[model samples]
Target: MDTVPETRIGWTFLTNHARVLTAIADNPSVRIRDIAAHCRLTERAVQKIITDLEEDGYLSHIREGRANTYRIVPGKVLRHPAEAGLTVGSLLSLLVQDESERSPQYAHVKQ
Candidate 1:
């Protein structure tokens, strides 16, 4: 794995898939470009991740004119055996923060 030459925060605890899902959870109508930017990933990578999530029943999207509106499949169990009983809703609850709760002033404050 390539490490960041600066901070050296090479890998994160959350997977790319989890990151994408949380982005969608934060804003159902978010664009793929925005997600790519937020996750620091390529747009193609984000598209593939979205496809994987949709194919596995973890997520779904609706076509609305020029944009796609996503709808997470809540209550769907996570795939890994370690997270068997955990649902998508629970996982998102842990990652997706409310806008008001995500103020920059509290960025360093511990929960």
Candidate 2:
């Protein structure tokens, strides 16, 4: 019997903070389940990401009945000193490719 090596991809390369920011940028009203699915992460992971983003001033949420509306602060600078003064928009552009240019697996989910 041969054992296969575990390989990590995509979201694994991103910090939870970055993932949540990207998820919200992709869809402000997106649910936790949907974000987890899209990001190839777990619901708990998504929830934690959201919490971290909110705590760090990168995101804010407003309760709207059964759903929460998220607002991203695009002007917020990244944490790294080398990345200081760079906005969330700049960071997201580097992390996420446009929908039309993505592979088929992600094409349908592209905005």
Best by lDDT: 1
> How many clashes in each candidate?
0, 0
- Model 2 stretches astray by more than 4 angstroms: 1-13, 95-111
Candidate 1: stretches off by over 4 Å = 1-9, 103-111
TM for every model, in the order presented, reads: 0.83, 0.71
- lDDT for each residue of candidate 1 in 6-84, tens digit (9 for 90 to 100): 4336776889999899878878888888778677789999999999999999999999888899999999999999997
Worst 10 residues of 2 by lDDT: 102-111
Question: Best candidate per TM-score, number?
Answer: 1
CA error at residue 66 for candidate 2, angstroms: 0.3
Name every residue pair that clashes in candidate 1. none
* Tens-place lDDT digits, model 2, residues 1-111: 012225475445667667667767766777887677666679998888888888998899998888888998878888889887899878988876686664443233323
Backbone clash pairs in model 2 (N, Cα, C under 3 Å; residues 3+ apart or in different chains), count = 0
